[model samples]
Target: MAQSIAIVSPAVTIDNTLGALFVGFTVACCVYGILLSQIYTYLTHYPMDRSIYKLIVLLILTLETVDQALIGQIYYHYGISNFSNPLTLIEGAQTWSFILQQTLGSVVGAIVKIAFALRVWRFSQRNFWITGLIMILTLGGLSLALVFTIKSFMLPDVFSVVKLRVLGTISLGVGVLTDIITASSLCYFLNKLRTGYRQSDSLVSTLIKYAINTGALTSVVSITTVILYNIMPNNLIFIGVFFILSKLYAISFMATLNTRRVVRGKGTDRQNTTANHTNIFHLGTRVPSMGPSDMAGWETAYTATSATQQEFDQQRPIIPLNTTGFQDPTLGKRPAM
Candidate 1:
C-alpha cells in the first residue's frame, strides 16, 4: 500500500504544478488584457492607423485572457479534487480557447509586424533596399501566422500528448524564424538611419529599438516553452511562461507610448519657445517703447521729443505776405514785389 501511494505521488505533484501555473497564467492574462484595453482606449483619439493597431492588440489580449481563464479553471477542476465528472466540459473549453488563442495571437503578431514594417517603409522611401527588406519581413510574418493558424486547427484533438508536442515544436520553429526576420529588419533600418543622419531618424530609431527588444523577449518565451514542453511532456508550466510573455508585451507597448509622448513633449516645447520669441519680436518692432529697455530710456525719449517740438516752433521765423503792394499802418506785414 505504501509503495502504491508513493507511485501516485509523482502524478499528484505534476497535477499540482500544472494547476498552479495555469492559475498564475490566468491572473497575468487578466492584468495584461486590461492594460492592453487601456492602451486601445488611449489610442482611439489618435489617427485611424494607430487606433487600428491598438484595437488589434486589444483583441489579442482579450483572447489570451479568455484562453488562460478557461484553461486555469479546467486544471483547477482536474487537480483540486476528484471532480472527474466535468472532465468533458473542461476538455472542450480548454481546446476551444487554446485554438482561439493560437489563431488570434498569430494574427495579432503578423499585423503588428506589418505595421512596423510599413512605418519603416514610409520613412525609408528613397532607399529601395530598406523598403524591400521591410516588405520581405512583413511577408514572412504573415506566412508564419497563416501556417500556424492552419496547422493548429488541422488536428481537432490538440490537447493530446502527440498533438501538443508536434504543434509546440512547429510553433517554436516558426516563432524563432519570425523573431529573426523582425529583429534583422529593425536592425537594418536602425543602421540605415545611423548612416544617413536624417532629420527624422531619431524617432524611427527609437521605435525600431523597441520592436527588436519586444520581439527578442517574445522569442525567448517561445523557446523556453518549447524546451519545457519537451522535457516535461505533460506539465503545464508553459502556461505560466505564456502569461509572462503576454504581460511583457503589454509593458513594452506601454513603454513605447510613453517614449513617444516624451519626444512629442520636447518638440512642443521647442515650438512654443519659437512662437513666443517671434511674438515678442513682432511686438517690440511695433511698440519700440516696450522693448527690453528701462523705463528711464522711454521717459528720456519722450522729453527729447517735446524739447524738439518747442525748438522747432521757436526757430521758425514770423513772416507775413500782403495781397496789395502797400501794408497797413497798424499791421506789421511784409510786401513782396
Candidate 2:
C-alpha cells in the first residue's frame, strides 16, 4: 500500500490573505477621497460652526491621514519590500506601523462615537442617563479595542492571534451595541419632538431617518468585521474590513454635520407663508440653525424653536428667541434656526 500527502506552504496562501489587505487598502483609499470632499463641503457650507467643531473635523482628518500613511507603509513592507520573502507576509500582520494604524483606528472610532454621544446629550435636552450610557459603551469598546490591538503586537504571527479572538469579539460587540443605542436614542428623542404640524413632523422624520442611516453603516461594518474575524481568524479578511472602519466613522460624522444644511434650507422655504404661525419661529434675533459650529449657539437655537412650539400648543404668547443675532452669510435673510 502507498500513501501520498500534498503539502502546501502557508506563504502560498498569500494570494487569499495578503490579497485581502491589499484590497482593503484600496477601498480605504476610495473612502478617503469621499472624506476629503465631505470636509470641504463642511468647511464651505458651515463656516460659522463652532471652533471646537471645526477643530475636531480637522483633527480627525489629520489622524486619518496618518492612518492612511501607516497602512500604505504596512502594505509596502508586505508586498514590495519583502516580495521574495513570502514567508514574511504569511508569518504575521505585525509591522512597525501596523499596531499604530490599528490603535489609531480605535481612537478615531472613540472620537466619533463620543461626538455623537454629545449630540445625543443636546438633542435629548441633556438627558444624563442616555448620554452617560452611550459614553460608557464607547469608552468600553475603545478600551477593549486598544487591548486587542496591543495583544496582536505580542503575538508571534497571524495564526497566533486566535487566542485573542474573544477579546476582539467583545470589543466589536460593544461597538455594535454603542452604535445601536446611540442611533436609537437619537431617533426616540427626535420623534418625541415631532409636533402634529405636517411640516414639523416631516422634518423630525427626516432627522430620524438620518440618525438610522448614520448609525447603520458603521454598525453593519463592525458586525461584518466581527463575523469575518471569527470565521476566518487565520486570514486578513477581517483586517481588510477593519481598515475601512475609521473612514466610515469619519464619513458618518461629517454627514451628520452637513445634513443640517439641507434641513435648514427646507425649514427656510417652509417659512414665510400662511403656515408661518404654525411652523415658523419668530425670534427677536437671528440664530444660525442647529449645527456643531457652536454648541452654545446650537443649544440656544434648539431651545428657541422647540420651546416656541410647546408655547404655541399651550396658547401662550410667542416669546421671541432671546439669543444674540448671528447672520447666515449664505442665506440673505435670517433662516429659521
Residue-level lDDT of model 1, residues 256-313, one tens digit each, is 4434433433221222232211111110011122233322233222211224434665
| 1-337: candidate 2 lDDT, tens digit per residue | 0011012343236645668879988999999999999999888765666677789999999999999999898889877887766666545456768778878988999999998898788667788999999999999988998888878889876567779989989998999999999999988877776657776677777778888998999999999999988987767788888999988999999887777646654443433233321332211122333333332333234322333443555795655676467555797777689
Clashes of 1: 0
lDDT of each: 0.50, 0.75
Q: Residue 300's C-alpha lDDT in candidate 1?
A: 23
Tell me the TM-score of each prediction against the true structure: 0.57, 0.78
Pick out the ten consecutive residues of candidate 1 with the lowest summed lDDT: 278-287
For model 2, how many clashes? Answer: 3
Native-vs-model 1 lDDT? 0.50
Q: Return model 1's CA RMSD, one decimal.
A: 19.0
